[model samples]
Target: MSYLELEGLHLAYGNAPAVENLNLQAGEGELISLLGPSGCGKTTTMRAIAGLLAPRAGHIRLAGQDITQLPANRRDIGLVFQSYALFPHLTAFENVAFGLRLRRVPDASLRERVNEALRVVGLTEFAQRLPANMSGGQQQRVALARAFVIQPRLLLLDEPLSNLDAKLRVEMRSELRRLQRELGVTMLYVTHDQEEALALSDRIIVMRAGKIEQQGTPEDVYARPRTPFVADFMGWDNLLPAAQAPAAARARAPQATHFAWRPDAVNVGLGEHTGQVLARNYLGEYQEYLLGTPFGHIKAYAPVGAQWPEGHSVSFDLPAERAAPLMET
Candidate 1:
């Protein structure tokens, strides 16, 4: 059985159902991300898992033990909120030790465990620093150390890295992955950032309006999205309305009755049709093109050197196999 399971979970605030018939499974030590936009129920689902909100129906299990009725204190789950939730008055070490102290662990053992947890997060050197003295990324690390100090059976992280700048967010991704692997704790992460989800999760649960839109490995979700929403959400930019693409386009595309192709997937200067480049953005690694095509404004991406100026004509071909079909429903 999965280590953490939420089966047929449903939740409603007053008369409005926020989540319905929701089911999820996380294997022991596996990291799964609940990914979606704001108001998509990802945060609500995380709250339910953390025992902040009781499900209107369904059960939650951890390591084969039913925790559906377990109160937040007894659930033995540690949650790291997006806000870090670190006490400004407490030093980093004190913050990490707060939970152990609350549980009245022996002084010697608590000190040892707290040191070990801080070390795992690479924050041992900053143990004496207050939240006000540390950078956003460092505080996030402290929050993580605090959560893991309890050695909870399950860990819930709600957009734990969203507060950091882009450069720091990238740097912390590797750090988070490393610590999670070292600890071997099951984690349920919730985030709206698609790139972060792809980089950090073993599997991703794509939710929409309180329901699971699709669930799979990063490659599966990116390369073979099961729905239009999934494809669009994952950054597939060349969306074609079902009735707009050429009849030949439909016959050639394989994944959906209606489909989209990634910009980089189209072969420029080698295909059956030619389009005029209406605009271009020169990213360092690649160039993005907006082409005026019969199908509308088609987007294409190519290597940095493989770009043409606006008003230049470019020939591009969509291989039948490269286009993805959208889910009919």
Candidate 2:
């Protein structure tokens, strides 16, 4: 049986629906991500799971026990939020030990568990520092340690690393993945950032406005999107109706109404079609080109060394093999 399950979950605020008929399952130790745009019900689903919001209808089962109506404190779930939510006055050790103190754990055991949690997150030296004294990454680790110290049945992280800078975010992603694996905790991570989800999740659940658009491994969802919305979200910059697609793409997926491909998939420098480079951006490893093509304004990525000036003509190919067949436009 799945370690966590949400069956026919219906959630709303007042008369407005936030999530509808949502069914999801997570096996023990799996890191599942709820990925979508803001207000797309990803956060709403997390809130429901954490018992922050009372579901309008449906059942939530965790470790074989129905917890639909369980109080947030009684749910045995730990939450780490985007803000870190660390108390300003509390030291790192105290913050991490707060939950244990609430549960009335003995002082000696609490000290051992808190220290281990801090060590696991690589924050042992900073245990006495206040939140105000720590860097964003260190504070995040403290929040994580706080959550991990309890060893809850499940962990919910709502955009926990969103506050960090690009470099720090990447570093923290690695740290979060390491800790999750080391501890083997079932986690429900909520984020709108595609790259973050792709980097961290064992499986990703792409949500639309109150419903699931797609759910799959990062490879499947990134390479073979089933719908135009999913294709766009997954970085498929070239999305064309089958009727307007190149002959090769149309021939490859005859039944598909829409076809999609990532910017990197477009072969540049030598191909059948020619396009005027409308804009070129040097993105370190690759050059992103906005090209005015026969089909439309298609985006393509070329080698950084292959500089194409604006208004220059370039040969490109939309390879059939690289195209993702989409049933919906």
**Against the hidden reference, what TM-scores do the models get?**
0.95, 0.97
lDDT of 1 at 113: 99
Clashing pairs for predicted structure model 1, backbone only: 255-325, 256-325, 256-326
lDDT of 2 by residue, 206-285 (tens): 99999999999988788778999999999999999999999988888799999998999999898999999999998888
Per-residue accuracy of model 1 over 1-329 as CA lDDT, tens digit each: 88999999998888999999999999999999999988989888888888899999999999889988989999899999889999999999999999999999999999999999989988889999999999999999999999989989999999999889999999998898999999999999999999999999999999999999999999999899868889889987887766776566677654455677888887777787889999999887888889998878888888887758899998887665777778755
Worst 10 residues of 2 by lDDT: 320-329
Report every candidate's CA lDDT.
Answer: 0.89, 0.94
* Candidate 2 structure, TM-score to reference: 0.97
